[model samples]
Target: MWSVPVLPFKQLISSALFCALSGLAQAGSDLRADDSRLKSLETTDAGRDWEAVGRLDRLGEGFCTGALIAPDLVLTAAHCLYDRDTLEQIDATSIEFLAGWRNGRASAYRSVKRAVLHPSYVYDGTLSATRVRNDIALLQLQRPIRNTTVTPFETDVRPRKGARVGVVSYAQDRSEAPSLQEVCTVMARQDGVLVMSCDVDFGSSGAPVFSFEGERPRIVSVVSAKARVEGNPVSLGASLADELALLEAQLTGTHVGSQLPHGVSRVQVGEPRRRDMGAKFISN
Candidate 1:
């Protein structure tokens, strides 16, 4: 198993964490019991429906899972764009989005031209409700994909606690092909962070969390970290509705902030972090 950082359960119950998560709670029906298992989307037939989800490769360093939100826009975790070692931002030119990547090939390949992180996001190699609540990023491709098979997904509001959700991602063990967990429940929602019973691991960062409530699956959140809540493993993500709007504004120069920096940063691969006060964030 990958040696990941562990946050104490007591810390989560404290006021510091709870204050960071204060927000209005939505009411939704409880999730029905279902067999939650990871199904490999290795075959073309089985993976056709999820063509927009792909691997965000940092060249020789490591990769994180991302999904297309528009013809030239990709959504992922903000931490994925920061180097774990130096806490520096990665260059957009060095990152590539392998849309519908399976086996040894991809449906469409595009280099990232720009990346915008949530303005409130800070990468200090720590985990907190504030960081997780803003742990989202948007990437602009050098060129539009415009592929028939690679249709972008629609974004939606955050799911209520106990709602059923799904995740498709590539991990350390399943690096070549992505796997789908079709039935994970939102265990809790605090402030703007979501804690779900989704199965994720290293390299699963930035993976899209889909809500199947409408006619089609819509992205509700992006996997930020995997944590053990009171001994049960859970995945953490930021509610996309508000955060996504801010990112889009920033990308279009409508938001009041500095433009995204241009430079190169490396990804941290298979590095064990010191067990401290934060959850096991997957930044590889």
Candidate 2:
């Protein structure tokens, strides 16, 4: 088990918008015994099938995980576009998507042309259900990746509690290539957030959480934050169905604020108190 400090219930309550507090209290034991270990996709053959899942590199800064949803559209976490120190939005041109990067090589490389964040998303540096729910963003690539091996993934509705899911992510320790956690349990789904028994860490933000219920896996959520529930580590993600549609609409100029320059509009919600709920944004 991951060694993480326990978060006080009061602090968790303060941070949560509509989380199932009762379910979270008992989440530690909800993980299934069959959950698979993280397997490194380091070799070309091993990572070939996941070419669409790539590293979103912020020029001089660090990187976050992202996945291609269309020929030119990349989905990722909204916070990945903000400077952690200054909390300022980063330039789209400075961002690059390194697809299927492994062992000093990549299958395809593309620069970001434009980016859009959920209008309601705020970068106040707090861990809240509100933030997690609105954490998704879409990046328009300067050039579409048309490689045969780099097919984009499709999005799907969120999974139910106890449903088996998987995650493909790059983290601080596993930065060169992505790792696949083929099996994890959705411990709880409250309001619009999913509390899952998936392992994630810095640089895993925006990593795609996939559901394999159908013939092919489809994206169900994006890694938002890593937290401890009942002294056990868990990853948090937003239910994608509605939020992803909103993001797509924003990208297609259908949403009200879609015409904004840089395609980003910021709304200020009352900032929640900054408390360490044993929660950390999974972005490097």
- Name the top lDDT candidate: 2
After aligning candidate 1 to the native by TM-score, how far in Å is the CA of 179 from where it should be? 0.6
Off by over 4 Å in 2: 1-25, 255-284
How many angstroms is residue 276 displaced in model 2 relative to the true structure, after the best TM-score fit?
A: 26
lDDT of each: 0.76, 0.76
Candidate 1 residue-wise lDDT at 245: 70
lDDT per residue for candidate 1 within 210-257, as digits (tens), equals 989889888988998875443446677875766777777777766433
Candidate 1 has which clashing residue pairs, if any?
21-191
TM per candidate: 0.80, 0.82
lDDT of 2 at 26: 62
* Tens-place lDDT digits, model 2, residues 1-284: 11121221234334343244434536447465778999999988888779999998887478889999887888898888887668789898898999988877888999999999988898875667777778889999998898999988887777777899999999888888899999998876655677788988888989999989888788888998876555666778865666676776777666633454463332211122232232223321
Model 2: lDDT equals 0.76
Model 1 regions more than 4 Å off: 1-35, 255-284
